[model samples]
Target: MKIAIIGGGPGGYVAAIKAAQMGAEVVLIEKEYIGGTCLNTGCIPTKVLLHSTEIYHQLRNEAEDLGLEINDLKVNWRNLLTRKELVATQLVEGVKNILRTMNVEVVRGYAKFTSTKTIEVSLTAGGKRSISFDKAIVATGSKSIIIPVPGHDLEGVITSREAMSLEEIPESICIVGGGVIGVEFANIYSNLGTQITIIEMLPELVANMDQEIVNSLEEALLTKGVKVYKSAKVLRIDRSGKELQVTAQLGDDPFQVIAEKVIMATGRKPSGDGLGLEEIGVKVDRGAIQVDRLFKTDVDNIYAIGDCTGGVQLAHVASASGLMVAELIMGERMAMDFRTIPYCVYTNPELASVGLTERDAVMKGYKIKVGKFPMYGNGKSVITGNVRGMVKIIADENTGEVLGVHIAGNSATELIASGAVAMRLEATVQELITTIYAHPTVGEAIHEAAESVFGRAIHIP
Candidate 1:
């Protein structure tokens, strides 16, 4: 069996490897560098910058409290950029090596479907090649959305990609949109001593996340001297002598923010254009490629996954879908269980969630009970000096089945996996409470939160 995968991203690469492992001849085509935006520009690069800034932030803010004395701490932007590039390059090379080991043919080019089973590649090095395959997978992924506003094309306005590779930290920055991308950049630059102003059109930042956890994050940002403007709309951007002026509307009032640079982190849209998907009888709806439950496109032998499908614009989600599609193509029946997928935000006090939120549970007509345990009550949180958030668990009131787990604190991203596992197995709150959690560990907070649902928590009054 011959398989052709487009877009060498998390989705495409994983599918290629799995299909190869399943004894299919695979060809992976990429226009740009491997590892896609998640590695080259988005997730990995941003995390690298965030990690450096986090260390700097900790030393600058907590050194005195922890009985350490340091002087004249500053950021070396060039060195940081170099390290980010190094990390990304190493990972990209690792992916390439793995693809080679799996014997997946990786073609460097731009791919467009000439027919249901044929893809014409305009090679990056200059010529065109035609690839004929028994099956094809589209994992084109997405790109940052640039809002259509006046003066957006000015020299100082930029996107998340540009924000990651900035030559130096700007004196100040105005970030539009307070979603994951915007809030993360705000956290990064703010910790690095760059004045940050986040303007979110929503009533609250990271509106998709649990609001209580978001409250903690917002509080953390406020404590860091980051200005937040909620329920605001950007009118335009204008130049003002070495700086950029952002005009916005807050309800009935006009608000303005002046900054050295402007970052447009509104969101991302599916990048399914130029692939000739529709020409091949595949449905394209508002830039997103439409796919069925098995990720099969309208064309019987063609499949679409990841950001192109516009289901969840998460790397792990894309990878999972890729794996599932590969199994299906190889004559194995596999299904994607999205309910257990964890959503994470890498902030000072990280945020993570699995399953339904309190609001969603109630809306779905489930009688629920909620339990929360503050991080300050956890010994590890206090020992680690990261007692700023809590663990919230929502369960079915009658059945005691754990419906959702939301966390905000140190290692929250890592800790949320336990919750994902529990939900995946349909574990109840009683089961979680009965589970042993080590003393002086942050995970104990999960246990206490589960106990709190029964009003029998020992850690709190």
Candidate 2:
């Protein structure tokens, strides 16, 4: 069985590797880099900047309290940018090496379907190459969205991609959209001493996450002197002498923010165009490819995954879909269980969630009991001097089934995996409480939270 995969991103590359391992002839095509947005511009680069800025922030703010005396500390923007590029390049090269070792033919080209079974590629080096396969997977990924506001094309206006590689840090920046991308960039720039003003159209930032945990993050940002304007809509951008002026509206009131640069972290949409999906009878709606639960498209031999499918727009989700599709093609019947997929935001006191949220559980008419353990009460959090969030567990009141877990604190991203595993195994609160967690660890807070579901918490009060 020969498989042709388009877009060589987390989704496409993973599918190619898995298919090749299963004894299929796999060819992976990528127009740009192998790792796509995650390794190139989106996840890896931003996290690199965030980590560097975070260390700087800690030294500047907590040096005295931690019994350390430092004088005249500053951030070297150029060095940080170089490190970010180095990390991304290493990861990209690593993926390429893996693909080669796996014997999956990696092609550098833009791919478009000629028929149901063949794809014609516009080679990056020159000319064209046609590939015939028994099956094809579309993992085209997504691109950042730039709102159609006036003066958006101005010199100072930029998107997340441009923000990553700026010549230097701006004196001030106004970030549009208060979602994950907006908030993460806000944290990164603000920590580097660049004045940040986040303009969110929603009532709060990261509106999709648990509101209680979001409140904690908002407080942290505010304490760092970052300005946040919620329920606000950007009308346009105009020049204000040497800087750019952002005009926005809050309810019926109009206001303006002056910044040296503006970042449009509005969101992202499917990049499914130019794939010849429409011509080949693959259904697409509003630029997103239509796929069923099995990641199968309208054409039986064609499959779609990742952001192009317009489902969860996380790299991990795309990779999971790719694995499932590859297994299915190799005579293994499988389905993706999305319920345990974790959502994470890499901000200070990182936020993560898995399964249903408290509001969603209530809305679904489930009688629930919620347990929360503040980070301040945890020994590890207190010892590290970064106790500013909590672990929340929502369980079925009658069955004690762990319905969801939400966390906002240090290692929250890493710790939330336990919650995801619990939900995946359908573990009850009793099971979590019975499971012993190491002391002097932030994860013990999860045990406390589980115990709290029944008002038996030992750590607090």
Candidate 3:
């Protein structure tokens, strides 16, 4: 079978590789760089900066407590950015080599659907080419949303894409939208000595995260001198001299902040333009391509995944969907399940969650019992002097079934995977408690949290 996968992102590339491994002829098309926004501008690059800033923050603030003397603790922005670029390039090339090894042909071009099984590619180099396939997978991802506002096109106004590769760090920046992107960038810049003011249209930051964890993160950001303005709407961006003035409204009051740069971390929308999807009768909801559980579109031979499908705008989710689609095409019994997928945010005090949140479980009419263990009590957290968060476990009250796990602290992103596995295996709180955890480790908080669910936590009074 000849399979054409559009957009060589996590989803498209994984789909291509999986199909090729299944003895299918696969060709992947990408318009911009491989690995998509996640690698090029979004997840990887941001984390690189975050990681660097974290070390800088530790050296500057915690060095004295650690009994270390440093005369000149400074950040080389250029060198840090260079390292980020090198790492991204290496990973992109690694993905390319893997695809090559799998014998999947990769074409650099923008693919537009000419028919259900045919696509015309406007090559990045020059000219155009058309490919006919027995099956097609649309993984064309998403782009940063640019809201229509007065003076939005003014100089010094940019998106997350531009924020990643800034030539010089802005003295001050006003970031609009306090979602994951906004909060992460605020953490990054604030630690790097950039004055940060986050404006969110909602009542809270990271509205999708556990409210308790969100509160902890918000407090942490404020403690770091990052200003947060929730329930505020940005009215306009006006260039004033070398700075940008951002006018915002909160309730009936209007205020403004002048900064060296203004970033629209508002959100992202599916990038499905020029695909001729409508003409080909592929269903599109809002800006996202609609797909069933198997990632099948209205057209039987075509499927869609990734941010373009709009179920979850996460790279790992996209890759998982791609694998499921490949298995479906290969006549395997498979379906995409998102119930226990992990969500991670790599800030200083990271936030991670898996399975149903407390609110979701309550809304679904489940009688849930919750256990929360403070990180300050964890031996490792106390030893490391980084204990400003906690772990929360939600379980079925009667059955003791692990329902959800939320964490906010050091290595929380890494620790959330255990929650995914526990939920996937339908493990009970008893099982988690019985499984011995290593002493003097942050992960022991998870074990303690499960024990706390039944008021049997040994470490806690």
Stretches > 4 Å off in candidate 1: none
Candidate 3: where is the Cα deviation over 4 Å?
A: none
Q: How many residue pairs clash in each candidate?
A: 0, 0, 0
Q: Over the stretch 209-246, how does candidate 1's per-residue lDDT look in tens digits?
A: 88999899999999999999999999999999999999
Cα displacement (Å) at residue 288, model 3: 1.1
295-398 per-residue lDDT for model 2 (tens digits)? 99999999999999989899999999999999999999766679999999999989999988999999999999999999999999988888999999999998
Q: List the candidates' TM-scores in order.
A: 0.99, 0.99, 0.98
* Candidate 3 lowest-lDDT run of ten: 331-340
Residue 377 C-alpha lDDT in model 3: 85
Could you tell me the TM-score of candidate 2?
Answer: 0.99
Worst window of 10 by summed lDDT in candidate 2: 333-342
Question: Candidate 1 or 3, higher TM-score?
Answer: 1
